[model samples]
Target chain A: MAALNIEQIALDIASPLAEEPGALLPILHALQEHFAYIPTEVVPGVAQLLNLSRAEVHGVISFYDWFQAEPSGASTLYICRAESCQAMGSAAVEAAAKQHLGIDYHQTSDDGRITLQPIYCLGNCACSPAVMLDEKLYSRVSAESLVAMLDNLPERES
Target chain B: MSVRVYVPSDSTALSLGADDIARGLGEIDLDIEIIRNGSRGLCWLEPLLEIDSPEGRLGFANVTAKELSTLFSDGVPGSAHPRCLGLTEELPYLKQQRRLTSARIGLMKPCSLDDYRAQGGFTGLTKALEMSCEEIVACVTDSGLRGRGGAAFPTGIKWQTVLSAEGDKKYIVCNADEGDSGTYVDRLIMECDPYTLIEGIIIASLAVNADEGYIYCRAEYPLALERLQQAIELATDAGYLKHFKLQVRKAAGAYICGEETSLLESLEGKRGQVRFRPPLPAIEGLFGKPTVVNNVISLASIPGILAGGAASYQAYGSGRSRGTLTVQLAGNIKRGGLVEVPFGLSLRQLLEDFGGGTASGRPIKAVQAGGPLGAYIPPALFDTPLDYEAFKAIGAMVGHGGLVVFDDSADLGQMARFAMEFCAVESCGKCTPCRIGSVRGVEVIDRIHQGEQVEENRILLRDLCQTMIDGSLCALGGMAPFPVLSVMEHFPDEL
Candidate 1:
């Protein structure tokens, strides 16, 4: 992947919206929404704009699991692995996804289309075997349905 | 006519395909306004739906897009489906809750300022801004409010400490790093009623005379982080958070940072490790200045206390443990969700009445209240009222109002092992008793589980637990052994 122009992007987004007392979170959210991940190069710029140190900006970004500094794949998949999901055959679904994708947890697909991640719980114990694909959530997912769902995704060419 | 529909923003509701229902409804292109709200805690028939009419909010249960049109055609105020629990307010579980901090939850659109204001949002802050810092502290003291973060320290005294401390650069730190398993109340409050917490934090900052505040939330809650970020923006724009310089910081899944001192270190961009206290956080914290580190619920309760006045707040609960308790009912339970009740409710009532017993359709053997560090109580002790003193008498601490139930299938010995293992993984390695003791405790418990020198192993494990409890620096190491020891004492048959 080519290097991102983080400084330019930060400048475009920076304003009074980025400097409020609760500004750090919204600024971080906007940054992630626009860039998918908080760019390391823009850390200083964000810090300067918010009157926070680069360390503070980096610390806040790194502390929350939602903020990612690295580039992400096209889509993110969060498979539930909590006790409730575990009881309802999520383990089987997880195994199948791993086999089908041929990738480990937190790793992106070779074609950079999908990234698989593990989530503790989705609060859908009754449905069991839940998975979140991008912003959309799926429930009562069987191993068979998981594969079919993946295969149905729009194909991407390198 | 503006037709109103409600879909839950609760994680459990989303897990049960509420998102699909919402999306499906959105796709219909109808002349209706669909609002996503929080859970009403009726977990059995989740993805509960509500329709707003000129009269009142109509309720539905386990609703799907396929049934929406038929339900609309019926013209019923509430669902007649077998799953429907009738009027939501009339539900036994919801009716019993005190709901001080959670008053607005599941009732309003999460991001709508108008919805929040309608539910009496910012009223406490508006009232608080009229009082001096001393008056605020006195009000909290009069309310008899204590820390809900397990320690049960008096909230008023904590604020007074910070207020009395000699420092211009004091800080208020909100500990939103809810790492304890089976607890999600903080996440729920942060997501559904984000402005309440923000308002509470701002009030706290003002009382402590702090120019800046920070909310350190864990990384696991992506939805919560998004909502909190949005709330912060809205609050700041409205000049609420601007009244004091308050910020929200996110923790990168480090369980150890739930301990106040370690949380401070993580905020300073270091590894989330615990620090020794002679200088408790109230004296020197967050960049070597006095800081008030409190849990989310503790901070969130401040607005209600300020608005209601200390005496009115104090009038609800039993001796010492005053105000409402926001209990996160989770684990092997039929109706697991957040429920806030006054301090005097019994454990049995919370588990059986609100939680609806075991979720697995098995008999409940034990319950662990107050997070991982809390003691495991047998079913026989269920009648005990959930107050700090009552729990203390029974050798339990209400760490955070997390009640994790377990069915008969649960092995106490294995659970003990998990407690030790959790400590071993989360220990900041700052103290020997926690770092080294937890690993040894796990090994000893494993030996007992393997049936090797059972009595000897039991005695050794007990000794190890005592040592860790006494010698550890912070609650991380200090209270790690509580659950393990409690399980061993109460459920020897499982061993």
Candidate 2:
């Protein structure tokens, strides 16, 4: 993995805010948008700019599940494990995805193409089984469809 | 020539292939402007189509890709065929609703700033910027709007407490961790009309004299989290959230943190655990200063109360439960979605009229109003008004306005055990009644199921429930018994 260019990213983020006390969220958003995660090194820079402690900045970043410190895979696949989705056979779909992608929940693939995550509910209960690939939600997802979808994705190592 | 096309992003609509319809429409080579809006609350005929008209947005009950071509050629969006609830304005399910919090939901394009402004989005903040903190508190107080996050404490009282406190750096935290089963109203409101929630939070911060705010949403709602983040950006750029320094914080899938104190603890990057309440969140919350901790529904409802004044909101409902409740209808229902209705509507009316009964084509044996903590009411008690006091009279709560129905096939004993087990798993373990009592309750229910001294176990379970209710520190332990006890008492045959 390439070392995160924290100073460059922080500089990029700092230029937009102009030292606003309330720039923490925007800075965090900007960092996450650019790198898909907040690097640990940027904590002090964020703290200094926002007039907050390093721990305070870290606390706010870690509190939100969407904010990650580590670099994420190119794509994320969220499989629904809520009761409604479970009732329809998400377990089998999950198994198929895990087998096909070669990654467990919260783990990125070896090639770094995808990260598998288990979400409790997608609010697509009526459709029974659901899986969200990035921002797009696919309902009534079967094991076959799951495999097909994974196969269709662009290979990261290539 | 502009064409208005509406595609509902409501869960029920999505479940019924609205996404496919939207994708198909996007692919079509037609000069049509698509507006992906929230549900109209007419869940029965979902994927409901509508077009811009001189009268208003003309409604069609349900339309597929095939029907869309014909409807467009006709130049008239006709009535909902076969299942037309007629005009959305006339439907009792929608007509009777106060719609304060959900006023902009289906009326405006969700992500469009122009639509939000046209539908009175940030009017409250604009009005509130002129008022003093005390006057803002007084306005909320006069409105009689209580916290819709299950506690039913007056919103005005909570804000007044924060306003009166001394602090240079206060925080306003909006608890969007709606962990309750069969409840997606918060998610709906967040996804469909994100500005309302942002506006509410901004207004709330201004009222409480807080400079910063955080919206603690659960990880389960990724779509809601994404939309809220996007909305925050939009709000910031447009100077709504920027004026108050508010940001939406996402939770790491903790159900217990739906409680205010627990939510505060989680915001500080600690485990989502409940804290004791003598200090009270209003006095010392969110990094040990004054904080205004509110639920998504509670915060979102503030803008309307401020805009319409308290009297206009107060005049809608009965007793202390003034204003409206954004009731979420889910589970085994033919029609399931978010419906913002006035407090006076009866359970029977909501279930039969809005919900259209069980989706399984069977009789609804039981209905669990509120979240899992709420009691399992029998069909005989369907006529009971859904007001907070009325629900309390029947040993129930309108908790977060989640109403889940179950068909005749449901097993009451199993359902009772599930509730106890749920409480056991989700308990913060701060107090004993919830920690140990839930385990014992589960054991006793299991004993009954096994017919091992069934009658004695039933008595034992009842006694345990009473002890837990009286001895528990918070609602987690206290309300856990409601579902178990209510099912045993009301649905003896099912058990």
Question: What are the per-residue Cα lDDT tens digits for candidate 2 across B1-495?
Answer: 767778888655765678777877777666678888877766556787766655556666666766655555544344544433455666666776667798878777677788888987778888899999999999999888888888999999999999999988889999898877667778778878888998888888888889888988876676778788887887678776555777777676556788888888777655556888889989999889999988888989988888888888889887788888988776667777668888888999888988888777899888888777888888999999989999999999998887878777777677788788878877877799999999999999888888899888888999999999999988889899998989888976544
Candidate 1 C-alpha lDDT tens digits along A1-158: 23456687775776657645446666776778788878888888888887789998887776555677887788888886654454355678999999999998878888788888876555344355578886666767889999999999877542
lDDT of 2 at B74: 41
What local distance difference test score does each model get? 0.78, 0.78
Worst 10 residues of 1 chain B by lDDT: B74-83
**Candidate with the greatest TM-score versus the true structure:** 1
**Which candidate should be chosen as best, given DockQ against the real structure?**
1
State chain A's TM-score for model 2: 0.84
Measured with C-alpha atoms, the lDDT of residue A37 in candidate 1 is: 79
Q: What stretches of model 2 exceed 4 Å from their correct place?
A: A1-158, B10-16, B27-29, B65-87, B90-92, B493-495
- Compose the digit string of candidate 1's lDDT tens values, residues B1-495: 657888987766776778888887776655668889977656556788887655467677788767766655544344445545566776777887888988888898787788888988888888888989998889888889888877889988988988998886999999998766556778778877888888888888888889888888765566777788888888778777655776667666567778888888877756567787769789898888889999988988988888888888898888788888888776677777677888888999988888888778898888888767787889989989989999989988766887777788776676777678778866778789999999999899888888999999889988899999899988877887888878877987765
Pairs with backbone N, CA or C atoms under 3 Å apart (clashes), candidate 2: B143-B310
Which docking band does candidate 1 fall into? incorrect
Residue B28 in candidate 1 has what lDDT?
61
Candidate 2 DockQ vs. native: 0.16
